[model samples]
Target: MKNIIIFGLFFLMVSCKSNPVTKLDNKTEVGLKGNWELTSVSYPNSSYIKINSFGIADSQCFETSSWRFISNNNQGEMALRKAGCPTFSSDITWYVNQEGNLVLKFVGADVKAKTVKEGYVLKVANLTENAFQLFDTVDVAGKTITLVYQFNRIK
Candidate 1:
């Protein structure tokens, strides 16, 4: 009878840990579903350091960019409308993972996201209804630099 109780307890413990709970912060995700503008892209230590933002455009190019996020399907679009910069738009798939990291994959011409290996992972920070920020760290000249993308929700 002791062995049977021990086996039952073991089975119960194993069953309880079978599936880990995942909290995706639905409130934050819902709050992000809307139109927003990239007001500023900044970093610490210096403001004139040259670097490309999102591997697609210069750090300055992302300023004043327009973005739209649809939470229902996790699809979005970002348009670059800055003067003298290349005018372009791209479809993107994004979601806030359990770790609070925003996973973004740009799509093109009916392309499958799983097949594409290129993507950007940015840590979400200071999320509010009106403003939020995405932080990315990159190595430049053997130093780790953090890039902050500040967004303001468009009313």
Candidate 2:
């Protein structure tokens, strides 16, 4: 009888164990839902500049730009606001790829070619309720540049 009781207790504990992968996926999904504002842009090779350090015009436009991620449908939108330029908004689909990379697909038809470009895959450095950081590398003029974007959740 004691052995049977011990086995029963062990079975209950085992049945209650949650899968780690499922837990992480849920946490990441929840953490990403919100309005995120670009706070800073970092370039390791070049001089790092804060969003506020940009020129008055650029600062105003950049400060007003933000990214909004919707939790219900996994869709996102990027809003760019500039004083002289017309307000630009793009439809984007976001998802965590199989390799855990954050992928942003821009939805639009190219004017000349009538082709849709591929999405941008960014490595997620950190993601939390209050902050998110993404890292990516770009090659420009034969020089490799590491781009880091820091965002803060809007209250």
Candidate 3:
């Protein structure tokens, strides 16, 4: 009876150990749960103009933007800080699709916010504990433009 009890306890302990793949997935999810600030935006296929957050002149709204992803709830918020500009805050539903694409669905009442209504699906070029990179391609004026957005986790 004593030997059987010891074996049972040992089996339970081993069974409770988390799978390595699950642990790694959890770590990646945790890494994405935080506030992130847009650091840079680049148009690689076109003019190759790389603009830093501070150097954004055309659109002040995007110059001071931040995103917060809530891993537990699978929700997010996009805050645009455009001083003296129309304030805009977007409640976003985010998820990783089966193909590993990062998808963002915007929920709001603003009719003018049509750009995000259909949802934005971006390729996750890179992701780490402190940095994230997203890539997408859009057609404008019959030209294909590749946009790369780089973000840094906010402390």
The best candidate by TM-score is 1
Task: Give candidate 2 regions above 4 Å deviation.
Answer: 1-26, 45-64, 82-86, 108-115
Q: What's the best-to-worst order under lDDT?
A: 1, 3, 2
For candidate 3, the 10 contiguous residues with the lowest summed lDDT are 51-60
Badly placed stretches (over 4 Å) of model 3 are 1-28, 45-60, 82-86, 109-117
Q: Between which residue pairs do clashes occur in model 2? A: none
lDDT of 2 by residue, 43-99 (tens): 654443323221123333544568888866777777766567446667667776556
Q: Please, what is the TM-score per model?
A: 0.82, 0.63, 0.63
Better of 1 and 3 by lDDT: 1
For every candidate, C-alpha RMSD to the true structure in Å: 4.6, 10.9, 10.3
Candidate 1 colliding pairs, count: 0
Clashes of each: 0, 0, 0
Q: Local distance difference test, per candidate?
A: 0.88, 0.66, 0.67
